[model samples]
Target: MVEGNNSEATKFILLGLIQSPELQALLFGIFLVIYLINVIGNLGLIILIYIISLLHTPMYFFLSNPAFVDLCYTSSVTPNTLVNFLQEVKRIALPACATQLCCFIIFVVCEVYMLSVMTNDRYAAISNPLLYTVIMNRRVCIQMVVSTYLYGFSVGLLQTMLTFHLSFCIINHFCDDIPLVGLACHKTHYKDIKEVILFTLAGFNTLFSLFIILISYIFIVFAILRINSAEGRQKAFSTCASHLTSITIFYGIIIFMYMQPKTRHSLNTDKIASVFYIVVPPRLNPLIYSLRNPEVKNALKRIIEKVFSTVK
Candidate 1:
């Protein structure tokens, strides 16, 4: 193994999801479909929110950020993965790997923070419907969105900086189970620090976001229960149910992908989990939001009708 240096030999081989040519072809086709859906769905949601005046609200405002982030998240991982499936060498240059690591962390962090903000938005709506608008005002919503991006960028920058400073072997492969920090340090002495940083960034961030989301939902549930009318309670819950479903699918897979002990993961299982972690959430977010939320559904119909009219 060669030490990490900025030379012609600084590339690493990526084994990809599978080694067999037949399996690679099958995986590529599946991933291509998933990637296209992720792109269209996320882009459609963002455009739909922007053009539709009726959908302009703090909740949907927060919703737009996730669509944007998920668009970026899937783009970072899926395209490279697709290319790798078709490659004979399966080797990734050091620069490309670094870029992937940077983008992957940034989007992952953005997703967690944005979901937490969505839960908080829900909490505001349920806990005080009268004051929901006031509490989740334009200014507060903007700040929350800004904070999510800043936090995501900060974590990505730190991890990237940490990795690039240290030396690494020439042939290391990119693995979702391993963090950039873990990839850098080859010595046993640094293993403790490496594990700590990896766990702190991947595990702590997710759990922390989940804690905030969980707390917000607890209050949301209490508020719904206190509503005098069954219709009122259902109305309140309908707003949050979509976000809750999204949170469940996203966080569940991400936790399994990054947080669980390595011994628990098998080779095939790991690849499948990673695919769902990176690709499935983005592809699913638009469908979940549109199907569950009335405003988005109506906005989509308007969009389609307008497009057909223009074509006619």
Candidate 2:
């Protein structure tokens, strides 16, 4: 992202997904619906969790943060994409693009590690139920959530600033180049530092967070196996079902999308994969919790009934 080496393209035109007008229109409609659903579902769950007195435990407390992160994650990317679907040139102004990239990175990093934090919370609950409350008190939960954000901010800001500062244009562009840094439209210059910084950030963030999540789940699995009662074991597993599903879905898509060697993958596939990866997870997070967890289901029913009674 260094200066003076790249063309002074004030705007980068995204080679939007499909060149066909008809396909573009169809995609526009489809994504618009998905965006709306994502917003409503994630926000609805966060509101419900906060409103329901019965859902005030450490688990729900952690759940609410992820719900909000999901909402923020959706907001960060979906609207701009929806706009791109209908545009003629798919142009994003320089400053606007920088802002979008920053927000996207922040939420993405927060979410990757937040899943591990939740896993640790689950391990404590399953393995040390007697001290779960004390282990995850109000202050501790807030600190954990805050640290996730702070870590996200540091990783995102540094990568954004460093990567964006380096120039990434030219005929022989590296595979791991920045997502929308005018690479398609301009041919400038490049260096080894560019690859180093990008790889370092991506590798460090993914591996560190992944290590924490795997370790926590290992303890969790060992604890679950030791429970003598079959029902107790099932209940413990059920508690982690939602988070595990989220981790599996998101990490599977994202890791495949980002961590691959750029040359082996097609840009078109990358675009489509990223679109689904970003949009689907947020939309599904709440639904997973609501459908799988009895508490969320009960709270939703109770709220609906109370609303109906009021209306009547």
Candidate 3:
């Protein structure tokens, strides 16, 4: 039975993106721009998808979901981090810290599973083109989405519970207030174990999903190569290029951060990597998908034209 300290620490101060004032200002500006772009781009994608009946296909369907998830993903971290940069003291309460951590974990896990589902969608389109509609129908799509959220939420609950359950007795300083690794102040030997579990879950989900994507692409590439017509091969390759680019960027940063030795787990490094997952990917995903997709571009153009015409 863990005893409660009613007089326990309430809040924690977050060391923003960087400690240097110049760097903080610079980073704040950069991230602000990125956040704006992320929100605009993703929101545009969602709107375009909804308004344009032509983009009701499975690919666009999955793309829009990730765009939404990415928006939430970036929101979970960037806003708070940005605010902390401006404030003299960036303090968060214990409940807020727990909430942030849980939210962050949930969105990230969702992104991972969503990417996997997107890869599978692509695989079906390429490998079983004739039955793509039947295989990835609305029911199936809904199930995939539901499962992704369920898996993410369940994993997040487990991790957050395990992490906060430990007693923070050893450190006299603020344990509850610090976000991320700051929660480790408890004389908990479970830090290593917790990290291992997190790494295992994230790593397994990412690597396994990546493996499926790779295998699917292998088959897809083979199919494309077998196509005698240049146009057919070109179309197939073009369809996959955007997904490949997004996946590479997403997993590249994740693997780089997690696959490293425990010795490399610095707070600054982790924060930077977290920025990649939270800020950069969300900003880039909509651009990548929209720029590559003709239907989306056309819809966006129409929407912009209508907005300008209305203002006039």
Name the lDDT of candidate 1: 0.80
In order of lDDT, best first, we have 1, 2, 3
Error of 3 at 100 (Å): 1.1
Model 3, position 63, has a per-residue lDDT of 89
Identify the runs in model 2 with alpha carbons over 4 angstroms from their true place.
1-7, 167-177, 181-191
Q: 1-312 in candidate 2: lDDT tens per residue?
A: 323644564655566767788998998899889889988898898889888889999899889888888888778767877887787767665666667777778888889888988998999999999999999999999999999999888877776675566443331211123454425334435435555666677777888888899999898999999999999999999999888899889888877876888676676666667677778898899888889999899889988999999999
How many clashes does each candidate structure show, in the order listed?
1, 6, 2
What is the full ranking by TM-score, best candidate first? Answer: 1, 2, 3
Cα deviation at 159, candidate 1, in Å, is 1.9
> Taking the tens digit of each residue's C-alpha lDDT, what string does model 1 give over 1-312?
354355545577676666799998998999898889888899989988998999898988999999999999788877888888888887777777778878888988999999999898888887877898899999999999998899999998777766665555532235343633344436665555655676778888999999999988888898889999999988888888889899999989988877788667555666677677887789889999999998888778888999999999
Better of 1 and 3 by lDDT: 1
- Candidate 2: clashing pairs of residues: 1-165, 1-166, 1-167, 2-165, 2-166, 2-167
The superposed Cα distance between candidate 3 and the true structure at residue 30, in angstroms, equals 2.5
